[model samples]
Target: MKGKLAAAMRNLGLCVALAGLTACASGPMDVSGTTPGPLSIASEGSFFIGGHDVHSDTLSTVPNYATSGTVTVGQVYVSYQVPTHARPLSLTLIHGCCLTGKTWETTPDGRMGWDEYFVRHGFPTYVIDQADRGRSATDIETINAVKEGKAPVTALPALFAASHEAAWAIFRFGPQYPQRFPGEQFPLDSQSGLWQQMVPDWIASLPTPNPTVPALSQLAAKLRNTVLISHSQAGIYPFQAAALSPNGIAAIVALEPAECPSATGDLTPYTKIPILVLFGDYIDQSPRWAPRLNACRAFADAAVRAGGHVQLVLLPDVGIHGNTHMMMQDRNSLDVANWVLHWIDTHVTAAAS
Candidate 1:
């Protein structure tokens, strides 16, 4: 029976063995073995890469702010340039799954990349290294705890593990359902797969910081303007975070972001903030692309209905191919950055007026 069950899952395009199931599985894969030093504050300047002044900054101190009773689960790697100008905005850049924050740098072609473009335009930009990715610490002890049953299987890490398992099950069981194993309806069967159902519960199980209230408080305290730029899968973080604190964020730029499944809740909270969504025409390559794009459309419509600003820009002649989700690496990435900067400038001006 067990063998038959396993065989059934195999036909479903699901992997029985969970990939990256280590204690370090929650974030991006860090195979570089380089440990970054403590964060610090620094000045704005240009770093030479390929014979050009690509705006860059050294690691500075982490911003000192009151924790919103949530343990900081991840170490955010901030590469920012504090530009000297009036009403300068600070941007937090979030990367997609399996990628590090370095993906935001300019390409070899000398076009201004996301980070460089923002910095050169006088916007301070910070990239977060989500927990278990890049230089961030992995919660190995937590994994061991859950596996040993010392912790609830429903704990955040455990939930995440289960979610991955569910994905694997679907992938493995999906293909066999109609052939090798017929008429067996696995509870995890769906095009969205099992991960969609599990992510929200996983996110809820994890420690959530009241980034909205505290981020707003921090902005108020510093009297600085702020915006969030999220790419690919990481897009969900800021969108949900902003939804949690809509009034705190000035604007949001979602670059080929993965959409939050509706089961998460009404994301209506974010509809009140200005949002500029940049989607690649090639988004359909991934299995999740259509669902994600649909989710983005719904969110965009909601934002517009709330009397908030929203713009959807589709990349011309682009499609799901190599590096489709990595807009920062695309040849036309600089063009997208330029448009984003202009959008920000225009919106800020409109807000002020």
Candidate 2:
């Protein structure tokens, strides 16, 4: 009788197998369970040497050969969560001038950054610390040489450093520090963190055929049809990468790019790729930025005339206000991200679907 009852319960799926024992199952069991994690991390770190040399030093206590090299370093760190459902695109975030990938990792005010948000929302986001910045490493000797009015002995590029006060006005946080626009979105209390993002930038390293372009292009190629999101000085990077590989980048979202393809530069390469240029508030009011913004407009206009798909979005015209150049770190950053996501959904994913 006991054996018959046990068999009957097993047939009805009420038994849980255990060591030398069987217990009654508790309600319905989850047959298809999800894994806790084996979260994968893909990281790249390296110094790409431009030149190498040996030097002799006589004042050494121990006999050691002195060696130096002209090199630029690159670090691309990425963590991705596959979308709950399939999506057709990924994102490669490039930081602007003087900043590193950490800029997108967290806001100055300690809010969740765009990188984690996008990854959580299903986009496989890749963040890069461009050559000679952030975790990648920099050539300080090169920087000091430039400061001392010395030209580089090798053909290697030079990096230029900017002042914090200048960045204050230039970023349009305000004309100067401690004097911000009324109701500005940037977190004034965390201004020091923002300043920490500033690093020396390589001159002549972002245009097409430059070493930096190829370095970033390689990353894009690995991503297979990624969308590039660039800010400030990095704005030229996507254009150069896309122009070089043409088919590597699926689209581009440039946030207040400091550089634009010259009006005379070829736009034919970008004709098929969708591009969006976003400008924060106070652009027109900024004497330092107004002229640059004008040039950007001309480039966008010219691109459109040449059959490129381009849209220049001004935040103020769209009802957002008091945003500095660092809108991603602004209070309403998520709102701006939503706009960008919508663009990606409509232009890239929708079309791919």
Candidate 3:
């Protein structure tokens, strides 16, 4: 007993087994004969450059404020993690609208999220809060301009938040909270906590060359061959970023994307990079998601025709059901994550072969 306690202290890690017994250093060890990492953050910082250099003479009669040229537009925050024995591949998780990198952290149900899960499974992980969302800073001036009708915006409409009912329907959570589909995998008991995560929506900055594209592209360029896992409103970001810098992305896993690139657009950038589009159950029931699915299918078809490798996975077809758009927070979220891990492994193997 003394020796076991000593070892536990040495490893300084604990795992709860199925038998409900606490074990220390009882699992697979790394090449160094140590337990796998516990998702330590390797680095974290914001990618920002919305400020003009303040240029003014040291001695100016005019007020320094007037002479100074300083204005900050925005910044995107990124958090990175690496396992003790990480695989060669890396993953970047991009959250959807009304969410942040927190979406990949602990779920409302108190389960470890994909960020930690992937790291434990040997993949370096990067979680991003896109510019103007979450931890990333936003430009109040730009937003106020749109709100005050001072900006000539061509594409995006005014941003707004959804009521609980509206969000329920939008998320395809059975038209109402606590009234989920039969055999629903979501933890309905935790609905209150989950609902608390809902944040006000940011303006859709699609037209006028959205700044997010360039910021995301810059992030991709900074990382070495990354696999993007984007969800919902963030689905098309990977495509755009990859198109901007084809060499950066190794692959993409888009979950219930709100949009996809046009089938008519050039897909040359995606030819070498593989893509997997995953859809959950209850999609057919949502009037909103039907067209999105069709668009994604068309995009996949176009990608395939362009000599790109793309696969679409439907949860129900694989015997997994009762999933909603927020599958990451569902009771079967671990199962879904396992499937994604398997897909990533397969891709890695294919690349090696």
Q: Candidates sorted by TM-score, descending order?
A: 3, 2, 1
The number of the candidate with the highest TM-score is: 3
Candidate 3 per-residue lDDT, tens place, 1-353, comes to 54455344333344434343354564333322124333434444444522223332221223443422454444567788775545678888988878778888877878778787777665778888776676665544444444546555652345767677877777777856536677767777787766787776664643344556666777766776688899998899888888888766778999999998888888887677889999999777778998899899998998898888988888898888888888888878867887887888787442232
Q: How close is candidate 3 to the true structure, as a TM-score?
A: 0.79
Query: Distance (Å) between predicted and true CA of 198, model 2?
Result: 2.4
- Error at 319, model 3, angstroms: 2.2
TM-scores of the candidates are 0.56, 0.74, 0.79
Better of 1 and 3 by lDDT: 3
lDDT of 2 at 63: 41
The C-alpha RMSD in Å for every predicted model, in order, reads 19.5, 9.5, 6.5
lDDT of 2 by residue, 1-353 (tens): 44445434443445656465544533222211222112222332333323223232221223463334343333333434443332457887888877888878778877767876665445667777766566655445444444445545563464577787788888888867657877778887888888777787764543335445666677677667788899998888888888888656889999999888886788887787899989998787788788888988998999999998998889888888888898888888877877787888888753256
Candidate ranking (lDDT, best to worst): 3, 2, 1
Q: Which has the higher lDDT value, candidate number 2 or candidate number 3?
A: 3
- Using lDDT as the measure, which candidate wins? 3
Q: Given candidate 1, what's the lDDT at residue 52?
A: 12
